[model samples]
Target: MSEVDNYEIVRQKLTLGPLTTPKHRKIRRLLKIFWNEKEINLLSHFGPADEYNSLKQLQERSGLPKDEIKQILRNPLRKGTISKRGTKYCLEPIIPGIFEKYFQRSRDTEENLKKAAILYWDLFKEVLPQQDTKVDNDWSLFRPLLPLEANEKIIEINQEFDVQSQTLPYESVKNLIDKFEQFAVITCQCRLVAELSGEPCKVAPSEMGCFIAGPGSQTMIDGGIRGARLLNKDEAIEFLKETEKRGLVHNAVFDKGDQSSIFFCNCCGCHCGVLFPPKLFHERGAYQSNYSPKWDNDLCTKCETCMKKCPQKAIYHKFPVKSDSSDEQMVLREEMCIGCGVCAINCSDKAIKMVKVRDNVPPDRQKIGNKTFIEMLQ
Candidate 1:
């Protein structure tokens, strides 16, 4: 078929992923910017975002020579437009896939980067608000991992659940870091996009980015993707601590609950892709940690440190009536909180403590919330 047909096919395949590339005019413009005609034609031979195709399979499907197929894939693979595993390759969704790959690297032209940034930001504002109306029943791919300091000592468990048997691994930043040996740090794509869009993050540097650990991450890092570097265990821990000190929340994709964490980010609500959309619409987008900050009224002193430190803006002061002499108490909008423990960790008066609120285990691998991973994104 023609180049237009190929682009349309690729768009359909992308929309089938967990994140969508809706058929907007801007999306068509973005697709062209990310992929040239030949690459788009090659991409049409692949299956949906969730399915990978072997080189042999692609060759048969496209009726192209193995060498020719490899040539077509070379640029897209380097650019991260395509996902790969050994000899297999697959398409990726626009938001999590191509948008990130395009902006995260310093190799792209300034003009092209500016174009992609504007389009993606516009897309987010237009499409995400639609999700806001349905926020009450929303599911999230990312969830908070409470601060390391929010240990059993600070967080109270439910009486019905045995405290001794409750081992919530990968539920805190430290535990998640300990689960993997090799680690790498890259610029936060969300912050980078914000910077490109002229709204730089105020909470932390874009360089204070996300942590990539676990298996194959080292191999991926070793490949020398631009704007990324390796980090040892101690450095990784230190990096997380630094972000926490800046009042940034630790968020990750922990598909296996206590057993697995694919990747994690130190995010500020100001510019985080996972956090910003919900914040913009005053809706819930991320899964909360099992803890919430419990305030000690007598000890609070009403200093408002916790309020300032909360990333979600969930904490607010409830001033006493004019007739009463009672001090203004710190109140939490529990629904607005992601149970990140940022306020608890930052409170100087020891007034805020994380308390175990809910105990729903995260969904298994290949699943997000109640949907199959692909279904959730789609």
Candidate 2:
């Protein structure tokens, strides 16, 4: 087959993933620039993002020798275009998969990365804004995690079930670190893109990026993803603390919203896939924990620390009509808050505390609310 035919086939396969690749001129150019004729031909043999195929299956399908097929896959495998399971491999999705791997390559030249960044930024503008009008708006792939020191008061609203139970591992940042043995950190894909586009992040450095845990993390560490760093459980916890100090939200992204694979992203509103889109799209980007910040008027000196520190832009000073009235108070916009606990942790006077408002646990299957990974691909 011709190079154009192979690229088109690969593009269609990519569209079958959780994130769609629209048949636009920019997308076509992006695919052409990223993948060569041979690579495109090999990628055409892979299944959708969610489906894994064995080596023998790929060799047979591609009509290539086992050694040749493996050799061909080496670069793309490390590049994150193709992800491997136990003994199988499959294509990565466009956003959470290929786009990240494409830019995170530490060995790639700065000029090449910047060129790719331009295309990706354009694609993001074209695609992400449309999410605002999506029919399913209840949940996102990302969820907020409350700070370790943030106060949690279990509100006793229901009489039947016990709401006084201890906090679960998934609910608390400290516990979540303890639950994992392997941990790894990589450059923030969003901030990296922004920096490459000559718009740097004001929140945190790109190196202080996603904190990935669980058994799956070992694959990333072993794969030699450029700048991928491994950390112990204790170090991981400390790293999370630093992100909080920088006013970054701890966003836990689940693999298809299932407990199978989870990563904690220290996200900033200025350049985060999950957090920034909410500002323009008016849609919930990440799931909120059952907590909301409760302000103490007496303790608050109107320092506006919380206002400056809030990643959600949820806190603001509400000034009264009279300047001498001394009625100005910081208002907590509960509707805008993702319950990240950034404000409470940054409040020096202990004026703000996170209180349990409701319960929201990640789903067991590959579904959140009424949406499934399959539905997303569709």
Best by lDDT: 1
lDDT string for model 1 (3-93, tens) is 3588888888885424666777888888887789888888888988778799889889889999999998888776667767778887777
Poorly placed runs, candidate 2 (over 4 Å): 1-4, 16-18, 54-67, 105-110, 132-139, 152-163, 178-184, 213-221, 230-237, 254-262, 322-327, 365-378
**lDDT of each candidate versus the true structure:** 0.72, 0.69
Clashes of 2: 0
Each candidate structure's TM-score, on Cα atoms with residue i matched to residue i, is: 0.86, 0.81
Query: What is the lDDT for 291 in model 2?
Result: 71
| Steric collisions counted per model | 1, 0
Candidate 2 lDDT tens digits, 334-373: 7678878888888788787666666656655544332343
Looking at candidate 1, the ten consecutive residues that score lowest on lDDT are 369-378
Highest TM-score: give the candidate number.
Answer: 1
